[model samples]
Target: MYKKETRGMDIHTFATDGNQEGVLAELEKGIFVDSRNEKGYTPLACAAKSPHASVDLLRLLIDAGANIHAKVGESQRQPLALAACSGSLEKVQVLLDAGADINAESPSGYTALLHIMFRLHDNEMLLPMAEFLVQHGAVMDCESQYRESPLSAAYLRRRWDVVRFLLDAGADPSPLRWSKLLEAVALGSCHDVKELLRVPGALQQRDRFSRTPWLLAAFVGHLDKARLIHAAGIDVNEIGQCGETALMTSASIGNPEMIKWLIGVKVDLELADEFGQTALTQAVQFGHADCVEILLAAGADPSITNEYGDKPITLTTSEEVVRVLVEAGEDIGDVSTEMRRILIGLEGSSTLRVSKSEYQEGCQRRFGSSNPETMDVPFWQEMIRTGIPAYESKSQFGDLYEMTCVWCFNRFGASFTALPDGRYVQIGGEHEDYYDPDFCIYNDVVVFQGDGNFTIYGYPQEVFPPTDFHSATLVGSDIYIIGGLGYHGSRRFGTTPVYRLNCHTWHMEPVTSTGACPGWIYKHKATLSEAGNITIRGGTIAIAQDGVEDHVENNEVFQLDLTCMTWTRFAAEP
Candidate 1:
């Protein structure tokens, strides 16, 4: 019978303490050999994982009927897995000779061979263990519930030595499913990709999503794999779902190497997506300046527009991009035939039910009437950098020389509200002080008359309305302003106070109703629809410099009915 003194401290405790004779004595007393500690470790498990564990102690525990396959950790690692994880070759051999399950997996589905491969910091160590396991009936494939077999898993984990060993051992040379190849490319596994390509007919395989490995590789700018795929007899011009070709994807992701390589291979340059957006349009939209230059030099037609009537130049305001397209013989300020089709197709409530003939007349009236084109030297003038106008003419335009010049733009969040008659209102935003060289902030407005002059209209001196990221939409002579960040008493806050500037009346009015405003936010886009609904969409709340988050996520699309100036949430699904 077990001694009463030994009852207080169980066999697991003896194993954890490395008391081999005490553990053997307990086994002699017929104490339950598989008894556990609070950490779910059996006595044999404690002994095997102990830093002080002896090879003889492990052998004795197995000789005493300790379940060698008993899993004993949070991940339920078997004793042999633990031995492999600990890099203990002697303990591993001892368990194997005593008939330990060499192929046993942890709760996470990692086998002894996998743990050996996983624990490896040195490849030569893994080379021996991997070879030993294969000789002892460990399955070479070693597939796991995580959807990776031993070969792909080693490849995915970047274990090249194990990967090579597994490949030499005839690891199923296929990444047969979407998840396997998806992991390979998405995680940047270039080494194993060479072997993955050797799978029978691997080039024609598509994921469940019908995306080839080439497509996914392009999706993330994985240029090495893309180059490899192109060389491996797969066409670089292959189109995936949504008509996403490799060249278009290269432009979309802004990968210069992929763009250059695809161009060198003569991939289609003018191929548009499902939405009729070309690679040039994609490059311009995402502000890839170098790609835009390359496409232009490669003879890409920079004059093309998308289905939304946005030409390559319209997608970006970069001067470099504009110069590239213009140099390629694309006129800067002209509407192409594509945009004319879009304007001619506009009807119904979208066009506010205007008659087709009248709309067509307006379209002709508006297109290319006031393009800012340059003339010959000594008469040429161009808008450059800021609002500061430059003139190259020998004589100045008549009234422009007499107009007042006000420096109106160290300003952010200001609205440039355009009018039908070619005049515009520059509404309120904060500006740095004009007097103090260091500059203070204040709320103000300016009015531009488009003949090279503007008038500064300062707000009330008693109130400094330093609104942040506000939006101003023009409706007739009145400009509606709503939802922006504000500052007062050294604290920042979101403001919902709605206001209107009546230019015709020469006064400001508090446009108020209980439901007249979307909750306060910053950086939102506001537009005046023809139906008198002022639609507000997308902006984020401001936080303090130390980042104390005090806000709500404003995701609902709101429309303020301008007739009543009442706020209402509308469905954004179109």
Candidate 2:
């Protein structure tokens, strides 16, 4: 349904317009041999745009003596340059291997690689072809018609890896072109790009924009790169176009490491930006606490207010930060009494002293150090003898102590053995705290079996009387035992027997005479609140008839009020 052009435009035009096979057949017929289109495009130039331009077609065209140097349209771009620009690497290699000029200048006088890099900005293709052309003795220093070489093109595109490879391959990054260096620094190609300015005469040579390498690197926050240039004996604190030093740029970026390095290298920290803000002031305004700490530790004045009259402490929302500034002798006039109290509390407890042998052992254990010099043995003994004291003077919740086996020292589950001395022993999870007979101190609550055969003897007398499997809670000066299955012999005395123990004597109070109370259960969590209320959570509930078979869940919450001496059912939705 398409009309052919009536004019003398030959089959070369047909090849460019999707009649590749028809044109090749006509060319083989030798009728339109060496025919030219109106635009002077050869059959090869037309076939370059065809999707079906196979290797056989290309070879046939070349054998028919087709002009490989042909250009399409007014652009006058060579087929090789067109292939490179189009990213057709196969077509490019085909044309190049077929005696197409590798370094043939385009209509714009740009070599294929330079044109590709400039137009497509593809480093993947540009780098390989550029290297290939250059390795094949394509001119490295040859300037394009636009006065830009491949090096300048790579630099402009910020392809640092390609730029580095190109430069090492003897591509001259002309120092006179200041845009190349500026572009390199702007694009973070500072690592090797700055080396271009380090060439013997390039440092002294100014760019076209009249900016030096030091100025450009500083402007772009390439401090490490700038430091490299500085190590070459250039001024570390060199002022740029706006009188901005490298230190000021680092301060603006809040890079503490770079600032520390600059200060160590003797770059003046006192140097201010155009707004008269020093590095110390910048750190405070940005609320970089570690940087502020570093600056203050290096003798930066925290008292110096910024333009808004806000000191370093005022900029921080952290209490520890304010305390740190105040401890550094920063004058914070007449702070709140509560703030003063909090700050005083922040002074922390005194360092605990330990013997040298224990300290070395502690250090060795903590740091995993085999070296004796790094170990502190005395610290370990003190840590073991007296664990850190409890924060409160009195444990309000009534103390809970864990007891383990002396040999195995394992934690006790529901199954554990009671020794003849009335001491409970567990297997596995043995620790030092388990062996301490004085584990439960004054007012500490201890749970024991309700069987009347066992007695816990402290120093002078029995601490807790003989009891069976029953739950107890410790209040101010008394131990209250609640309902449980009382033990006589091997028989279960299922009764709700309540007992109260004072410092003088233990007395039993019968709460309820209900027959066959719930069976004895252990390993239950007992909690005592501040309002004289007791809660027993999560334990087995069982009713003993003749044999202990119907043991249901005691997952329900139970509460006892010591003031009223009455039990209340907690209405928690199950």
Q: After superposition, how far is residue 525 of candidate 2 from its true place, in Å?
A: 76
* Residue-level error in angstroms, candidate 1, position 336: 48
Among the numbered candidates, top lDDT falls to 1
lDDT of 1 by residue, 1-574 (tens): 1122334247877786778888988888878787766677778788777767788889888888889888776778888877766667788899888888888887677888777666664545666777777877888776668765666655544455666677677777566345455547655478867778777777777753456888767775788888777778877778887787888878876888888888998898998888888889888877788999888788888868788866686666555665576567543333232221222231112112224343223211011111111111111111111222211110123323422222223344555554556455555443343343322233455454545444544445333354546777777787777766655353334336577776665355567745635565666767666788887877765444456656555676888887876777665721
User: What TM-score against the true fold does each predicted structure earn?
Assistant: 0.36, 0.33
TM-score of 2: 0.33
Q: Which 10-residue window in model 2 sums to the lowest lDDT?
A: 405-414
Cα lDDT, all candidates: 0.63, 0.52
Query: Model 2: runs farther than 4 Å from truth?
Result: 1-20, 28-40, 49-52, 175-574
**What is the C-alpha local distance difference test score of candidate 1?**
0.63
